[model samples]
Target: MNHARKVHIALNVTDVNRSVEFYRTAFGVEPVKWKPGYAKFDITEPPLNLTLNHQANIEGKGALNHLGIEVSSTAEVLAAKQRLREAGLEVIDEMNVDCCFALQDKIWITDPDGYRWEIFMVKVQDTQPDLTVPQGQHLQACCRQ
Candidate 1:
């Protein structure tokens, strides 16, 4: 896949204009193409080609757990969080969270029509499991797996 320059994602949205605005703020760039019921974004930093398709039925989102952009460092994650907040977008953040044997920092935002997105960075690749917690300690949603 070295020849592939970017990954493409087509999302079904209830309102194209609204979604376009959200993405415009999220990506900090205007769409390369835009029109009624459709918009396209060529995101350079994350190497993503994202599109919005107006759909009457956005309920069946098709096995999509969530969408994410992975960054290189915790500072990058915090920078993304700050940018998102300054844009007046509601952001939920997790810092130094241990999940799947990795310590990660992440910021989450939900787009119009209810799609979740995350900008994240893994601080540590692998971490030893903690033995202090009692058995059956509830797991955070990200750590469920």
Candidate 2:
């Protein structure tokens, strides 16, 4: 596999400082570029180019579906969960859960703008491609054992 470039995403936030703090705590890294009403994070291992730009018309701008970071190990997932919790952020943990056709251990965190961020580690690959989760239950909420 020749994955060569980082994924870039720019988000419009009502408050830049708050979002920066939240992402900094969640990713355990500081933004490579930070300025008034703008910030950029150059994540290496995950290869993400995340940017937050302050805007007055942030509302009614269509919500982001969600964002996720896939890690390599269970320990990494647990560490990220702990770090988020320590930063006074609400984290929901799902261990050994099947989601998106893969078994994973993950933690979910919602940002100030209601953008959900999931940190996960895949443990198993699913052979079946069923996409139906139960009614009133989400993929993130499927790990109740």
The deviation in Å at residue 129 for candidate 2 is 6.0
Which residue segments of model 1 deviate by more than 4 Å?
Answer: 1-61, 128-145
Q: Largest TM-score belongs to which candidate?
A: 2
Candidate lDDT scores, in order, read 0.65, 0.65
The residue-level lDDT of candidate 1 at 95 comes to 82
Per-residue lDDT of candidate 1, residues 1-145 (tens digit) = 0122355466766666778889999999998756545566879888986767666555856534356676766777788888999999999988878743457787888899777877766677446434222332322223221
Off by over 4 Å in 2: 1-63, 127-145
Q: Write the per-residue lDDT of candidate 2 for residues 62-101, one digit (tens) a residue.
A: 5243466767688888999999999999999998886544
Please give the lDDT score at residue 124 for candidate 2: 71
TM-score, every prediction: 0.48, 0.48
How high a TM-score does candidate 2 get? 0.48
